[model samples]
Target: MNTPQLTESIKSLVDNIDREYILLPEFQRDFVWEIRKTCDLFDSLVRNIFIGSIIYGKPTFEITVREIDRRPRKGEGSRRKLKVISLEKNEINHKLQISNFRLILDGQQRVTSIYRALKGIDEIWYVAKNEDELSDEIKSKELRDRTLEEMLYEFSLQEDPDRLSIKLADAFEISKGIIPDDIREQYFEKLSFIAGMDEAEIKENFKRYYTICIKLGELFNSEVLISYYLLNMDNEKFALFFERSNSKGIQLNFIDILAAKLYKGFNLRDKIDELKDKYHPNNLDREIIVRTIAYLVSDGKDIDRNYILTNLNYNHFNRYWDEVCELYNKVLNFLFNENFIISQSWMPYENMVIPLIIYLRESEQKDFSQMTEWQYEFIKYWYWATIFSQRYSSGSNEAIIQDANVLKSITKGEKITDRVFFSRLKSQIDSYEDIYSYSKKVNVIYKGILNLINYDAKGLSDWNNSSKLTPDKKLEDHHIFPKDYIKQQFKNDDQALSLMDCVANRTLIPKITNIKVGKKPPSQYLTELKNSNSKLDITLKEHLIPNEIIEGLYDEFFTDFLEERSKLLFELIKRNVIDKEKSIIKEYYQAPKVKGNIKIFATYYSKKVEATFDIESQKILFLGESHSVPSATNKAKFYLTGRNNTSTNGWRFWKFIDENGEEKYIDELRKLSRK
Candidate 1:
């Protein structure tokens, strides 16, 4: 169903394009070449050098298509945008005979260049022996603000320009022997001007003029430089061809392709630039914008890639674009107020907000500010439950839409059909063993903890300055026990060293305070801060740092401080987020299963509690005992924390080594297993 016709003449390609025997697909991005490339292309053709082969699809099925743009992509031409032709297949076939058309699947730039040159459409091509030097000189003049009128010889302009050469359009007409007496005289006048117009010289070079006409004419009608393959295709192969490549060799993402498809009514790239905000200053995520449009167009039923590709229409763009932006801003504002999202850096996933958009649209909330206390509380539950649960970790389109439906019911204050939130959301939150984990890891759960502390305290205050922390601008995930301090004290104890980075050991504070605090232990920094500032306790409260935790900063009590703060963090989530109790303190611990490992080792100073997991059995063999992961983790943690540990959620007391040979808390392994 194909032929590699190396013998396809330039004349045949041009003739077919002129008669509408060849077409371009509707989704093809308009010509992407500069005038220099066009000139280089002509230079290649005149010398009969091989350019890349163009592919033409002779499709028996009718596909949406548009004419090539009237102008080259770079040079000056028509300013109007293209329009789409959406018609029934039967009507398109009979009325336009699309099946008879050959679509240029590749080498669009090459074909378009030659077509423009032969037909003399977009820009004038010139015949000069030293065309490359002329092209370079013209480029120099362009950079110096000289107009094309001042640089090139336009016979219509009747001006003596700096660079004079034979215009191909005039030469083509003359070569066909179609010039009238006066027109032929005008051509000679331009040609003679290039030779400095001496009457004696004109008489001497008359035969050279005839030779130029014969040779250039043959060059214009020449064959064999461009090879083409004509493919007799069906719709499926045509689509596969486009997937690997479109008119260009590189594959564009769907959002880019959609922009081309909607070129008639919208300049999507320009529109998205207008939609930028602080959270996404460079540009908003294009896929989310497309997904929002897809959601609105399908009336909230579908937002998958294929559905949007085949179904998105222009009617909904204007209607939904502004509102989508508005709703997203409102959602961000709501999250910012609660400290769930302080800035772009604190955002867990951009797609996670899609559910909030669904809730806003479904509830028809005119202004999010007008929402009641119950609505705010509901959002907090959803936010905490999803983040702590790590639900939307990957491939979450269906989950987002599903949760959106559940949230819609919340707007109506209906029965919560998903009883897990009411009953076990706390347990789900409690299940992660790393609740006391530290090092200011920027996972949603870790950030969620920081948000919780900030929310409960109204805002995290600077320990040194006594001012509110503005994390949107500059915030640091400051460590209470500096990594240097821990490494110095426990240089040989891998288990002791492993506990330094637990989320419980870190706090969100202003960068200025962190810089002033430096690598000093909490005992040293807190004493220095307390001596200078009387209300250091108030700042400490904001960061979930208890006075006792700082009091025990000696080397012997490093584990003691970690144990206390981890318990405090565990209790804070349960009280503030899980319980909606308007606070950030509760002391508990629990551990979940490890990921990518059959065995996990929990470290406890000089000793260790090693365990192997059987996911199928859902059990852990602890040293000589067989127990559920939680029971085994609890026993090890309580024994490790050594008498200070209470009814902890438990996994915070344990540690494991990951595949990277790095020691981690069992809770980190739990996060991997969930993923």
Candidate 2:
């Protein structure tokens, strides 16, 4: 193994960076080290800790690079650029050459961390008072330590060419007029220490000479170990190494790097922002849009790290950008119309939309109006089939590539029958027993069933039209045999409890009806519902509720009810989704009830609150009322506040009495569910 060079001083590295001799690679993850962590890094530097080495790749050709932001923020809009010196003036159109940049394979966090602390920007700096105080590790390394003496410095960016700085008091506070009161106080404390020292003592011990030479010397002389790799102009090789290294350590993220490289000078970030404004998609959605464009432009090729690395530039995207955008928008519209709400929980595999968009783009014949009814049917069948079969759940890239090629052919007038498609989908499609074994709505397959039923089942609820089920319409997962009734019959049989929660025993009903019919046997609810609504028979038929089971709703027949319902559901889905042939898939449609059960809770919240959540629809009954997940206190807060918006700290605020007779946060339940 070749040993990395460790001779570069901080000044040398900074100089190389300014002169364009060192550049960050397009595939390197962004600088996201927190401010305090950056301060800890500085502490390590002063303590002479070996903070680890940086890895750099030397490419044969010029590559697009981004300078490390000396001032990093949680969001991109708040970031400010580091002022860099020109290595060479532009001889052409006079714009700086973003292409002639160095690839930083590792240690970007350390480098930027150093840069920000040295600048005294964003309050990411600390000054140790004495060896005694420094020995207190906790006090010495706190990122936001209020007690530490703050160091302020002035940088002459234009005049110094080298961008050198000197502390104002000791360094001389050039930013004194603008510095905040708290920050100024920090600096003042350090100044007082110097003021107390005699001139000779200050010069000899504190190293405060005519210039702030000590600070400058320590900063410039600090050594950063650099492990440099020289390679040919193959982005593919570089990307493989980058991905492997990142996978083993902190994930910097490749999307931004690729985005910057591909759309250099084209303002791709602005385009994404525009899309965000229009569609209100999360960060993942935006990334999917970019990936979709890449996949289609590459002519249905598998999107691997190697492919992404080489295709960093937009030369290919430039050709089909408009068409991809148009078709992608149409796909989102399709999702909206189909009641496929685009939230994290509702949508399954956003990448799956790419192939569908590709088909739509190609099938439109460039006019968006050339698709025929047959093509539409094929699209619908392919979409639902892909979802039901978990086509993109794993090995998604290979699956998408396979589907893309097949879809391309299908769009070109080649006929693909259910038998042929099912053959391709056979390995992925679970057995009839697997589908019937699903006892919870957590599975995406369950969500898919609900979506299909929403479109297929009509006139089943108070809304008067199931076919036009809007995302806003609150729907509840109603148990066919009420939980209490099931427990009364099965008593302590965990297997029965598990079976009762299975998808086979559930149906989507209006939220109000779910609460009103809670714990009541299906026989009683159906009979009463039928009497109250004249259209009950048609509604039941649309919802795939077997008439035979409803007629015989005794507690002893609960297992039989699930069996019949499961069969009916299998037939309904297979016929409508795969193909409309009878007896063709009977072999794959029968599910024998698997014995053995697990105890699942009602997992609910109360009904009285008129908040966004509905008690009946959410099925989360808490404190004797039915409230959705949002109203379930802790779990609901996490949802209502939007993920990561932990201003309310649901884990702290949302408490519940555990069965163990102890009060615990509801988020504990979520953690248990994950396990």
Candidate 3:
């Protein structure tokens, strides 16, 4: 409720002006005044001064000043307030007071420009002289040395009179119409106007404007008032205000704010840049990375969009940033080596899969550097396949996290050995082929691994063989259809087998180099494989079937592989059987039976009715009825209809009324029943 303002001459406005008053907050925008618009304001002021027009009421030039109030309080908590003051009216006295305040909700640029001009820091367009055009004497001369008549004449003309005869003649002609009542009197008067003006005039104007017009309202208590003002303004006008009023108009983006919160207490921007440079150098979309990190860190917490967009606080950003950086580093280190040759896709399945890696490393007592080449390859394949396979991608983050925890528990430590993880992973990969067709695959695989691990640990030893390992574990999920290749090849068939380009079919290899192999057959990478590692023994490994396998060929290959792996897995399960009662025996297995029933209703007119029923097996039964309509004479016609058993694969029966007045049964109905 406190109100204070000050107004002094123009001299005070310029001399006392502080750069801080012109600065917008970090949340504000940039300077956006067009050059032409600024030039126009300068030209108008100069022309009005040259015409000797009386400087009347303030020429509607106003500016809103905003300052952060961080003064210490008497209470326990530190309170931060924003003060907005406007400069509106020019008062009679030179004394500094609040009534001299002007309404400057915006327009900081115009006021600043005027203040600059009065201080001689800014050259009025008409008075500005080109260095090359001006004589040395005229350029170096002080304003006091110039004659009053000459100065007035120079001001009247739009050209510099001291430069050339052409400009001097122009000044003379322009001033010819101005009858000098008293040249000395006018000169003294103008000099007084310039000298009497003080720097405090502008400062006081700015202060009063800020204090009375803007800060005087309950703006410190309610931010909504300012927000409403901004919203009501037109886009261009508001944009201008945002530019000038906001310190340099550097508004933080939603992602920027979220990043700040996510990386709170840390240099989040730097961390993000570092990760991008280290892992995704070519993909510079920092916003996407930030969003992904935020999503991951939120861990299913409900977040408001407005909080992300507007209310992001610096402290929260710092904290979130630290956690994010730590997580990002862990992920990068696990997925890629220091050399940066290997990069993993961020598929949803990897959400659970990567955690398993951490669990494995911890359980196996192996740092990333100590992992065998084969172990790395196996883990990488499992992680990539699980992610891109679409099996776990559509699930909620909680579901994915839960599944990951389950995987970690199953694969951690000695349990991470080949036989256990691969068998489980292979089943998961196969399930991707027919998500619905192989609905039980994941559960089956999960159970199978648990079963095997529970029984004989040696059964899984073969998977631990170093000979089975590949180098660097840097395999990408190479699609046979080559996503792009498939898009081009199969334009019309949405359900075409090409759509089955999932982890089940995907295998890891060298990154971009493998992409060059495209949709080519496996033979294409054979040369590169030989060159990179001589120990690699390429063979007709049933699992290494060529990519050229068409739909018909794929079915056979898939079936064979499924059966072979299944047999190997089944043996492992048998060997590991801790509980013989729980073992799945072939002899005890039975196919499930289909069960349900259907019934039909028929209506008949009946004064008197006759009924007959026939029994079939326990699964079915039939009933027949006959009724006669009332007649005046001794005879009346009877109608008959029958309801029969309609159980699935059950028997059926039929009965109908004859055309005779007397009811009679027909064996033809029974024959028709069978048909």
User: Evaluated with lDDT, which candidate comes out highest?
Assistant: 1
- List model 2 lDDT by residue over 1-675, tens digit each: 235464678766656665655666655676655444554454445433345677776555434566666543322324234444323324212333443345578788887766555554444323333221123343233223322223222122111111122332223233223343443345333443333223333333233222233343544555534333455525544443343345456664456567668666456667767766765443336556666766765756647655765663676656655566667777766666654442234555577777767677667454335666666665666667777766664445666776775566567765432233344443222344555545446555766665566556532344233233344446667787788889887876655665777777777766777787767677777777777766666666766776754575555677677777667666657766556322233322222121122112312222112122221232354455554343344444334333331112222233444333333343344333332
lDDT (Cα atoms) of all candidates against the true structure: 0.59, 0.51, 0.32
Which portions of model 3 miss their true places by more than 4 Å?
1-271, 274-312, 335-342, 346-505, 511-675
Give the Å shift of residue 531 in candidate 3.
8.8
Q: List TM-score per model, in order.
A: 0.47, 0.43, 0.28
Best of the two (1, 2) by lDDT: 1
Ranking by lDDT: 1, 2, 3
What range of 10 consecutive residues in model 2 has the weakest lDDT sum? 154-163
Best by TM-score: 1
User: Model 2, residue 48: what's the lDDT?
Assistant: 35
Report how far off residue 419 is in candidate 2 (Å).
Answer: 11
Backbone atom clashes (below 3 Å) for every candidate: 18, 26, 50
